[model samples]
Target chain A: MATLEDLSKAVINGNVAKAKKLTQELVDAGVAPLDIINQGLIAGMNVVGVRFKNGEMFVPEVMVAAKAMSQGIEMVKPLIAETDMPSEGKVLLGTVKGDLHDIGKNLVGIMLESRGFTVIDIGIDKSPEDFVNAIKEHQPDIMGMSALLTTTMLHMKDTIELMKEEGLGHVKAIVGGAPISQDFADEVGADGYAPDAASAVDLCKSLLSK
Target chain B: METFNTTRSNFTRASFEVNQTIFWQMLSDDQCEEIFMTVQELLERTGVEILNEEAREIFEKAGCWVDGTRVRIPSPLTEWAARTAPSRVTLCDRNGKRALRVETTYSYFGPGQGNSFVLDPHTGERRKPVKDDVAATAVVCDALKNIDFVLSNGYPTDVKEAAADLHVFEALVANTTKPIIQYIPSVKHAQAILDMAVAVAGSLRELQKNPFFVYLIDADGTLVHSDETLAKVIFAAKNGIPFIYHTKLVLGETAPVTPAGTLVVALADVLVGVLLSQLVRQGTPVIAGGIFTVRDEENNMLPWGAPEVSLVGTGMSNLLRYLRIPSFGFAGASDSKISDAQMGLEEAFSMLHMGLSGTNLIQGCGLLESGLTGSLVMLVIGDEIIGMIRKIIKGIEVNEERLARGVIDAVQPGGTYLGEEHTLKYFRKEFWWPTLMNRNRIKDWTEAGSKSLGQRATEKTQSILQTHQPEKLSDDVLAKLREIIEKAEAAL
Candidate 1:
């Protein structure tokens, strides 16, 4: 029987196949699903987060580890009750309209998911209506918009305004990108602003806590 | 030149012939070849997007595949263009005298251009820069011994936007006699700036022969060149002005996320400008380099202080050296908002790394806040840093005299060498003296008001501004420069 420690090590090493196999072994051994998630997968990702913050690991390495942890999470997710599942929060992410840049948004999604948030990425060049409809569909705890161009960043304000018109103002909104700053975020009436992906995760957590 | 020969005479045959100097390489011969081959494949397969119709026509005439704006250059054309581009470019001062030689492993340090804000030397507040800031920057750069060339450190917002490049050039030419690298927005500005340079050089032919200033033309990244950029490239080539075919690659946005992938894209982007220049005029002098920045994944900003910048920048320099093109790159820049410890740390490391790599034109001397702000204090600090880097990159010489066998024998049994004549003969050349750095004892430092590096640098900058008198342009040249600026303003 595979111990939870072995599963955690597999996820930390980013050995996706071994992580999946060990997760299966734990499931066959009748380990609890919540225990497998908290001890095996999140435990490994927690180490990755620390290592990344301490500069011992880089973005790609953390990304690979997150992939491994997510794969293991997928295996045991069906066995758990909806209320019993571990989730920090739900976040909807997209690049603003007329902007095709998505690398930053995708990285934020990966970081949020690794921290146990349910992330729904709406993809690139999303119009204001697209953001409102996605927020209505996902009913996420936070909405994150990204834009790489100065021209396209204006749509972030439009998206927030449309959200207010659609009576979705209770859902906190966050803005980020190369051109997005805290002053612009405040001007756009966003709930918060993050400079990069790591801070985006923190911004979401802080907004949710508030 | 006589002094150089005299200094070299001390090296014995064995020491002179052997490669004993310390050097740094980011890529080996095989790695350079692999990257070069990958760049060629990328250029042929993916090609570049040339937005100018004339540039597209030129590519088509050169037997490249031109589909609308997408131009695919063959490997042979790139190889041929690399061969035709001059390996050495000499930049002259305002007097049309050769001052800087851009070839081989020789590196020259200078400030950057296009900063929007200036750190007020007196008030220490960030504000929009005016035309006087450009002249002040030039004056400081002229007085600094290590800064080999001058670039307008701040973009003058007070001038007309269309002819701001001309005004900045006028200010630089008026204040400093050092060689300048000009930043122009369009071909019109390029022509006007060239007119002002010609006024100083006395004629276009005389200007081209000694080419005091270089035009900076940038390629929009992701293998794209805009219409205005290509026009300036063509203009500079046709007029026989040296220009840096440069671009700034932001990882994961305008370029690939990985360093090697970014290198491929960077080389392809710069080569588009290079090939276009050579297609316009054979033997056109072009320097190839770009400000390589990694997008800080945490901040979502293209950070100037990242170590990856040095790594990728040195790699690009090595590639340019491999292709036998003069290289330009960024160093002595910081992301910090002030001249703090972080600024010093970042600037020192990047300057040391690029200096050791021997990049031809290492820019970014006075830049702060990731190139958004310019600080004269930072320029003074960078001058000191470059002086130290020059000593480090010179490496140690091994000779019968430098090994000091006779001196050691004479100073045996723990005798003091501080009083020896041998120490007196070599101490000045062997040591790098700091102008702004503090080396006083703690008591003496406190007695001297306990100034920090930033305070000392500020004092040095103010002193330079007050005391240093740069060589002025002649009255005839001044009147012609004024007429050209007036015409440019009227046109605008």
Candidate 2:
């Protein structure tokens, strides 16, 4: 009796166990793995995303809903092949060197995850070396650097330079923060800039499509 | 139809100009009445010192305890003052047109008067402000939409120290047609400034109906007033000059440590001012005004933006509401040395707090470094903040047109309403669009060059300075004003 709509509601309510159980039931009922992943899990997260953008939903609620979506995805993962997992893209995310501010960066990561992008958060105060290593190891489609301070944001340019020198030109550069702006992004040779979390997901998707 | 009244055949037609103010008070009606009662008791029991012979005679004639300059006013006299003072006060612009209709708690915001220094936009240094600085400040205020009136920001160090006020007054009067609330140091200076204003008005009778400036006088601290303070009151009352009688109470220093004790002292100070002004002439337009702030014991400094100041403002507003007089409080000010993050946070809190506390006229805009310096950049950004607060005060409407029930139904179940007719009908009015604050996409912002909010504010100030020109005083009027000042200099 557990339907895909029930799974979507569970994800929207941020009920991880209910979401996973309903997703498993949908899998057992022979619903296509891609259909449950899109029509159920991502469908629920899309509502949360829109609500957050409209200022109706807040970050804690978005984080909780994202957790439920991640759990639901885990339940439907085994039925789908690795190459056909339906991820929009992989993004390596971090707060750039000398900047410990990560609340915005974490919100951006969760938003990307909810939008079907795999977000690998290397945490705050990341060095250019750490970013380069992560780019080589993860081979992420996008590299995100955030800095909330003026002194630390200079490292954004350094990390972008490392990416360029390493010949990882396919990995697009993205930057944002309290003091960061589109002009700063262009000056540092970043591919895109996002002022806030919801827009960060959109920025990654648009950049990946190109 | 049945007859509605016995004396009159039909009920009178009801008509009134719409007063769009979101009225709010932090105290209840009973509590507000209690503050007035406390003020009366303090006046009747603990006598106030009236430092002028004429002022003391008026108090004594109204049954106050007179011992030298110390006079204890009776409760009846204080009540008489509240009853006699005009319930409505109007502010007229330089063109003799009514601008601010002040009788209720409809908040109007403007910068402060007589800042000794101004922040130079070009050099980014705090320097002594001159006459040009006053004109520049007035022009910026004229350009700002939220700034309803002008006040002399610069003390004009270039002018003679004995006549700095006149220079400031002339500079402000020259630059903006907006009504001003500023000071004249003495009774003689008040007359000279009025003469200048009258010259600009083309006649004495025209100046009477359209006094473009309001007088501000200090009641000092508890139970003490200077002679000139009372003299200004008499001049303003007899001449029909609108005035605000105010005091600055510093808790644990000039007043008691507790807010209640300080409130009582402040209330008595303003009441005595009102009583004196009313005694001079009935129906005198007067505002019951005071600023109450406690020193930060930990830091040993006056926290102008402290929450305690807002509390005092709220309590005083409640008292004035019950007394049926206008309220004035401080807002859009900061303790920070610069217009940085701290300035933004503090000013936003103060402006919104005082705006919601039912003040009719709010001051202290563009003030920073604890009211020591005035910055045009901060004044411009303060406009953006007040505009945002205005949107908050507008709130959300839940009626049929605002609710957009049909639009919601149409967009239900994963439908977007971005292209809907309802959206077009309401978005511009409902949403508060920022004029200076950036909301551009990162690529565009980076393309435009990453600018901070401070930089943006500075740029706006620069642009206004370059483009915005104010109405000028006529050549003959200027000559007449200078002549009046010359006469005052020869006499005083």
Candidate 3:
């Protein structure tokens, strides 16, 4: 009796336990793993995203919904093939060296995650070598560098140079921070720049499409 | 002189047992102390980047640590500057009458400056604002009972670019007698505008004694002071002109994203100007305030309507009140493109918040589209909103006479107190009558054409533009102002 509609409603309401239990029930009921993910979990997250965009839902509620959907996704992950698991893209995020600020970068990571992107945040005060090593390890589709200080923002350019030396030119590089403008992004040869967290999601989507 | 004396003590009471009016505060005493102490620590440790050499030398002479453009002031110097700055600054009208006592819990609402486009009064189309639009805004502000002062609402595009400030000052002084707050770009414009104010006051010393205008100088954010901003501060201080030292810290840009962190940067930005002014001339009348807001990530705009504006604006007002300095704030502004529901909601909430917080000078009356456009219609509607806010902030009286125990006893259980003398005596004083807002029944409202608030405001604006004539300057003063503008035009 645990239908996909009930699972979707649980995800929308951010009931993580209910979502996980329903996903398991649907799997036991012999429903396809992809069907439960597409119709139950992602369908609810799509509604959350729309509501957030329209200002009807706030950040915390969207975050909770994202958590609920991801919990449901974990229930179906082992049953489905890795290639069939839905994901927008893998994004690697870090705050540049000499800048300990991370609030903006963290917010960007949350926003990207809520939009179905796999965000790997390496935390703050990361140097160019750390970024290069993270890119090689995560092999993400896009790398984002954040810096709150003017002095540390220069490290974004250095990271881009090191990425080129490591022959990771195929991975798109994006930069953003309080002091980062589009002109500065262009000067540093970043693929794109976003002003704040919400735009960072859209920037990632556009870059991955290209 | 009589008006000046009475208006000075009008709102400020010598002493009161209980708070006489609605006293709203966002930050507690402990929080205020913490923020102020943190501001001092930030100033002493990080210091600010000063681009002006003379400013650095002034700080160095005052026993501050000056290493090139980085001048760090001791906390004692900052406390001394706060103590030295006058707690109250009085601004006079062009007719030499006190118009605003910029201090304490007294709040005055007015329009903002430098809107490039204006909502055309007749066609309702957005277009570039000209000098006549500036004059029209001044005239309308002069007629509005709640608008306490006037700011150049439009940056005149028709004027010469180099001398636009002088031209705007000329138009404002020519049209309105209310106290003017002018924005100056550089030291030259500051002196030129001061010369014009001197012309109106008849002499330099007279202008200094009762400045009809206050210079508004903005500081570059992120702990930096540009040379032009410093030069203007020096000019305003040396000439004994009262100036508002203002800055805007867009949350997460040019400042820390957190409200407390933004406050630290904001206080640092403003105190740097205050110290520089006081160092140039002790007891310089400097009002410190700024815009603390977040950039809309989606639209990439600094929204004037965001609730953070009220939160941070009230918080900053509380900080300035703690420091005992007159504060300024932004209110009655919106990111909406027109005079619609969003605009009304945004402006009403901000106006109410600023009024409740008792910000001394609340600007942004008619700003629209994130402060890119000005609308006289919006200004008219905002005046009505401010009138309502003023009544709300007046609070209630609980004395015996106001309690009306005797009147209630005499009236007895719904026996038509409308006919009583007590009712006749207290009705007008107890009520706030709306001019534009309708309180009529549906039938009556429909019979009267059932106009929306926007339509009513537009009509009121057109009527004011048609008939409201501001107090004029003397022929001699007018000629002198014209001559100064011409000279600046030629020189620049």
Note the DockQ of each predicted structure.
Answer: 0.00, 0.02, 0.00
* Model 3 C-alpha lDDT per residue in residues A49-160, reported as the tens digit of each score: 6776665655545655666788788778899888877789999999999998876787677678756788899998999999999999999999999999999999999999
| lDDT of candidate 2 over B1-492, digit per residue (tens) | 011111332454477444354556777888777877888888878778889888998888878889988888888888888878777688888999988877766778899865778899766799999889888988998889988887877688987778878888888888888988878788888888888887888886787787778887767777798888888888888887788898899988899888777878888888888888888877778987888888888888887777788788777777887788887788887889897999998888988988776687888888888788888898998999889878777655654455565666665755544434455445557778789989986766878889999998998898998999888888988888788777776777
| Model 2 alpha-carbon miss at residue B394, Å | 2.0
Point out where model 2 deviates above 4 Å. A1-210, B1-23
* Candidate 1 global lDDT: 0.86
Docking class of 3: incorrect
The DockQ-derived docking category for candidate 2 is: incorrect
Give the better candidate number (1 or 2) by lDDT: 1
- TM-score to true structure, per model: 0.68, 0.69, 0.68
Off by over 4 Å in 1: A1-210, B1-17
TM-score of chain A of 3: 0.85
Candidate 2 clashing pairs, residues 3+ apart or interchain: A182-B442, A182-B446, A183-B445, A183-B446
Docking class of 1: incorrect
Q: Which candidate achieves the best TM-score against the true structure?
A: 2
Top DockQ hit = 2
Q: List the residue pairs that clash in candidate 1.
A: A195-B299, A196-B298
